[model samples]
Target: MIYILYAVLYGLHIAIPFSIRTEWTVLIVIALLRAVLKLGEQRTNHYIAFTLLAIIRDRVFQALRRLCPTKLEGRDKGDLISLITSDVELLEVFYVHTISPICIAFLVELIMVIFIGSYYWSLGLLALAAFVCVGVILPVIISKRSGNLGDELRADNGELATYMLESIRGLDETIQYGGGEKRLQNLTKKTIELSEKQSRLNKLTGVNLALANTFILFFDIAMLALSSVLYSRGDIGFDGLLIPLVALMSSFGPVTALANLGTTLQATVASGARVLAVIDEEPEIEDITGKKEIDFSGASLENVTFSYGGDTVLNNLSLTFPENKIIGIVGRSGCGKSILLKLLMRFWRANTGKVSVSDVSVEEINTANLCDMESYMTQETQLFKDTIAGNIRIGRLDASQEEIEDACKKASIHDFIMTLPKGYETKVGELGETLSGGERQRIGLARAFLHDAPFMLLDEPTSNLDSLNEAVILRSLKEEAQDKTVILVSHRISTVRIADEVIGMDEGRVS
Candidate 1:
């Protein structure tokens, strides 16, 4: 397309001097058609590129999700958010704009160089060598210089984003303690680091681009002079001189734009590496592929031992909880009570021995099916910024409105919810900030009840409630445990008093 366009435009420019070789009407019509065709080609290429990007986006997200189970632990949420949102988005530029255009430009430039060489071999060689220096050598050198800076900038940006998010979440605490100034000072420090790294990256990019422009300009002048000399010496014809000049001038636009795209390309490279980091992470535990479904008749652990780093949390642990009975596990702080709950949920596999439910190995159970068989509540309850009814409905997504209210009533939070201005429709605010700690725990309990699973695992269910509220919630739990296997972990003696069996655990061992 470019070849034909250049040929026609230059032909018209040269032919117009001698009483117009072709009629003006025909030339105008051809020029208009070429313009329209070029526009159509650009739009079509853009559409095709965008379609390819849309397809790749799904695969990228899936890869990130599959890597999540392993990547989540000890990770900063704000950093992950930045990676998924900003860093990943940068790749779209590379996919939709950079990839195809770079290839097309390279092929176009190569063809122009060859055609120019056919006419004026010496001049074409000069242009070809200059193109290589600008397109290949210069870009590689700039990338090496800016690559590390880009990575540093991205890392700093992720950290700054994380800190900002953390600060926002803890704003109330900072205000309460009159630590706003201190927090601001810390944030200022992060901002400074981010600014410094960003400035360095910008400077590097600017220097490389400036150098490329200078080199391109020098080559342009040199090529024009060389072509003029060859023409003056009768070494090349007027057509040869003018055609190569026009071709070089027209084709240099593509490579010049490519040179300017370097900064984004470098950033894209860094983003790609960051994305691959998450995609390549190995999960702590491997899922069982050929495992049968779990039987929730009873749950037991046999000779189990586990540790994090050098600290042993569970060792030679063995216990059994008969089906349809409330089994309480009580221990002091740091006694691995919550860790036991995690093990039951298969969040972490035991280092040795076996954990089984209804005589089927927990390690061998399918994760999705295992989750369907039990409802596990964490100590620190998490709630979305949604209505009370919506939060409760998460326990059983298909639960009717009546069922949600019933579960809330069972958890002893329905009365308080009704007294609120919006009742069950009120937004909980971020992480249930509108509700008290006790309210959040009850909400979690409501979820467990709505889940209607065969087994319920509660980790400190009454940790946040007042004595009256605690007693009411415990009574509700006791009633629910009648037909379900309840594995309870708590530090409060009153909380465990309702359990049918209370097992004492210390330093990861059953006592």
Candidate 2:
């Protein structure tokens, strides 16, 4: 449209020299209109891009939630973070720039060809051919030559991100072991490799752009030459010679945008594929929905068999725990103590037999209800960067201050918390780095206490606590055992000594 107006104004300047004032007024109006259209286009494009990005982000988060713990086990945390952050963000290229411009280029090229062809059939054909080459053919060729470079670049980027995060998280260990220099060297090597891959991609992008420019230049020269020949033969006039030449030269804008997208689109496609892979991953255990909620009475594993990757973790395990009993599970490490608890929690499906609660198969129980009825605490408690009170309240979001404190007392950490500078308000640094291991364990106990579920699964709950703290926590567990079924998993005989019954395990067998 801008080129058409420019052509008409140029012709007027030459054909009607006295109409310069009118031509100037028309030129200013066209310029202002073009500015308004450009602004509108930008506004619309950004609106679409931002809205799509938000939806994609939400979808990615939902996917993560679905894949977590089980499907995401052993997955690289940093790679997942990169996918959710940068990979998802890269999609803006496709939504904002690629989609709209491709459509606009085709439409504009069609209109330009028909309009130019009305003046001269040969010129219109030339424009059509040029548009195909620049808009379609060139991108296809460039994309093919790029040859999985985008995927390789994305994979390298993920690896680098993972390595960087690992180095940062393990910085203290690296320093203590006098391996800081080695860690730094490893990081530098990874960084340089990533940079080299990116440089290669950038070089390909530069070459692709050069080829597009060459195509535009070739078409421009060809169109002008053709128009000049028609003008000299009296087949057309000077206006005809200049108008199509200017329009064809300027009309490459839309197609040129597409040509530029070819290189970037590869990365976007790779990112989109990774994002989709996460969203499409099948969960290890399909959640049972639309099932009746069962009241917690007792749980039993009947000849349950399970494996991880092919090695048996639990085999022919049969055990029963009556309601409201403190049943201690004692086993050596790798003897399926924690695995039994996970099976009952339905984190994994048993390969054979049944893990049932209230005489109902866990898979047949509503997942939300099952989660609400059981509170499982692991040896390593995870604490977020939040206030002490906030972390404790995670067990029960609506727990009152008194309830939180009471739970903390039961966990044998209330006095310690009160002595802190900010009491319950003190912020625990990332992964509870600001607190001691025993303190973190007490916080986990507090969470379990605050939850007050019908069943509690404690895996090495007192591992980090000193003798005095362990005794206090164990006493609290015993006191709570009257109302809740407690499955206490511990290697320490002293911790399990308080339980009403004890089950020993060895090499995936219960005794």
Candidate 3:
């Protein structure tokens, strides 16, 4: 439409001397309308792009939750972060620019061809050929030449990100071991490699752009020459020649936009594929929904065998704990103590036999019910960058201030917290770095306490605490054991001495 308006105004300006002023006024109106439409198109495109980005991020988060701990174990954290952040953001190019432009290019090309061809069928055919070559043929050729370079480049970028993250995280270790220089060199090498890959992709993009421009130039010359020849041959008049030529020349805008996306689309395609992979991944443990909730009367693992990779972690492990008993699990480092706790929590599925609570296999228990019935605390407490109160409230989001304080008191950290300047309002730095190891452990214990589940699994709950703090926490555990089933895992024999029953594991078997 813009091209047609321009051609009419041009014809009027040249052919009608008296109506030149009117032609100028009409051109100004058309220009203003086009600008308004352009602005609206941009706003709509942005709205769609942003909305899709938010949805994509949410889907990625859901995928992460589903794959967590089990399927995501040992996965690259940095790469996953990249996928959720920059890679997903890269899709805005396709959503906003590529999709609409492709459609617009086709539609505009059809309109331009029909209108121009009305003047001369031969000129219309020429215009159609130019659109196809620029919009379709060039993109296909560029994509073929790019091949898997986009995938490789994206993979390299992810790898570099992972390496940088690891280096930063282990910076202290690197400095202490005099490996900083080596790490720097490794990083430099990876950075250079990424740059080289990026450079190659840029070169391909440049080539595609150059070829597209050359084709446009060729088509422009061909259209002008053909129009002139037809006019001289008397098949068409000067108006027919000039108008269609100008329209065809100006109508390459939409197709050119699409032609420019050829190389960039490769990265978008790669990122989309990565995003879909995570969303489609089958979790290691599928949550069974719509099952009857198990009452936490007692729990047992019957002849359960489990393995990690090729190494057996639990071998025919049979154990039972009755309700309202504090069961202590003691083992050396890799003797399946933590693994046993995970099996009970159903973080992993046992290879054989049954892990059951209340005579029902864990596989049949509804996930939400199982979560409500059990609370597991790891040896290393994970705390976010949030207020002390906020971190504790994670266990029970609706817990009252009194409940939080009560749980902290049970963990024997309430007095210390009160002594702090902020008194529970203090922000724990990232990963609870602002607090002592023992303080973080206590906070984790407080979380488990606040959860108030029927069963609690504590792994090295007091490993960082002094004897006095450890004793206080153990005493509280004993007091809580009157109603709650406690599965206490620790390396210290003294820690389990207060338990109603104790089990020892060695080399994946009962010792």
Candidate 4:
């Protein structure tokens, strides 16, 4: 449209023959309108891009939450971080710059061909061929030749991210063991490999750009030659020849945007594939819903069998726990002490027989209800970076400050907490690293106490505590069990001495 307007001002003044004043005014108005429209187009594109990226991130996080503790058990944390950060970021380029231009280019090119074809059919055909070759054929050829390089590059980048994350986390360990030199060398080697992969992709991008430009140039010359022959033969006038030739030359803007995408789209495409893979993976265990809610009375595993791959962790082991009793389980390491508790929690499905709570199969109980009835504390308590009171409140989010202190007292950590300068408000640092192992363990116990559930699964709960603190906790557990069933697992015979009945597990079964 701009090209046509320019021609009218320069030479086609005879055709419109309005006043020269009117023509100039119209030209200025249209130019201003075009600038306004272009700005709006960009604004709209970015808004859409931002909204879509937000939605994509939300879906990724939701999928992660659902797949967790089972499907994501072995996934690399750094790789997951890469997907959330860099992979999604790569797509911002596609959404903001890539999608709209392709649509605009096709529309503009199609209209131009039709207008030129009205004057002469062969000229239309020539223009059509030029647009298709540069916009379609070249990209397909380049993408095919680049096969799998994009995926490989993204994977290597993720591995490099993982290595760097590990290095930062183990910085203290590395210095203590005098392995900094070896660690540095490994870091350099991994980084160099990543650079080489990226270099190959960049080389492919350069080749694509060169070929795209070549195709455009070759077609431009062909357009001029064909239009010149028709003009000389009197089949079309000078206006017909000049207008189409100019339009074709100026019209490469949209297709040019596409041609350059060869630079960023490879990574974008690879990132998209990786992101989609996470969303598509099936969860190992779906949450049990729509079942009758269960109240904890007593729970048992009946002729239950379970395994981790080929290694059987529990072999048709059956046990019963009476309500309101502290039943102790003692075993060597890896003798299925923890695994038995997991079955009762339904973290893993039994291979055979029924694991029951309230005499109903665990599979037939509502997942939320089951969780509500049991408070299971693992051997290693996981604490976030939060204040002492804040971390304990996770057991019952609405607990009062006094209630928090009460639970801490029962866990035998209230005196230690009071001795600290900040008392209950003291920070635990990352993963509770600022506190001793026993302190962290007591916090876990505090959380469990605050929960006040009908069933408790305590896995090596007193492992880190001194015997004095351990005895205090056991006495508290004895008092607390009047209304809750407790499964106390430990390797220490002294730790289980407070229980009503003690059982031994040897090689995945009762002895």
TM-score of 2: 0.94
TM-score of candidate 3 versus the correct structure, residues matched by position: 0.93
lDDT of 2: 0.87
Ranking by lDDT: 2, 3, 4, 1
Question: How many clashes in candidate 4?
Answer: 0
The TM-score values for the models, in the order shown, are 0.90, 0.94, 0.93, 0.92
State the C-alpha lDDT per candidate: 0.80, 0.87, 0.87, 0.85
How displaced is residue 492 in candidate 1, in Å? 1.5
In model 3, the Cα lDDT at residue 90 comes to: 83
Question: Which candidate ranks first by TM-score, i.e. highest?
Answer: 2
Which has the better lDDT: candidate 2, or candidate 4? 2
Error of 2 at 181 (Å): 3.5
The sequence of per-residue lDDT tens digits that candidate 2 reaches over residues 1-511 is 4444554756666463335576677777978998998999889999999998999899888888777679888887778877888888889878888899998999999999987887699999999999999999998888888877887877887887777778888888988999988888988998898898889889998999899999999999999999999999998776678778878988899998888877777778888998999889887877678998779999999999999889998989899989989999897888888878889999889999999999999989988899999998977899988999999999999999999999999999999999988899988874357688889999999999999999999989998889999999988998899899999998888899999999989889976
In candidate 2, what residue range of length 10 has the lowest lDDT sum?
11-20
Q: Which residue runs does candidate 1 get wrong by more than 4 Å?
A: 1-57, 67-70, 172-179, 286-291, 430-432
Off by over 4 Å in 2: 1-28, 430-432
lDDT of 2 at 379: 70
Candidate 3 contains a number of clashing pairs equal to 0
lDDT by residue for model 1 over 173-262, one digit each (tens)? 989999989888989998988888888878877898789889888887888899899999999877766767766766676676667666
Q: How accurate is candidate 4 locally (lDDT)?
A: 0.85
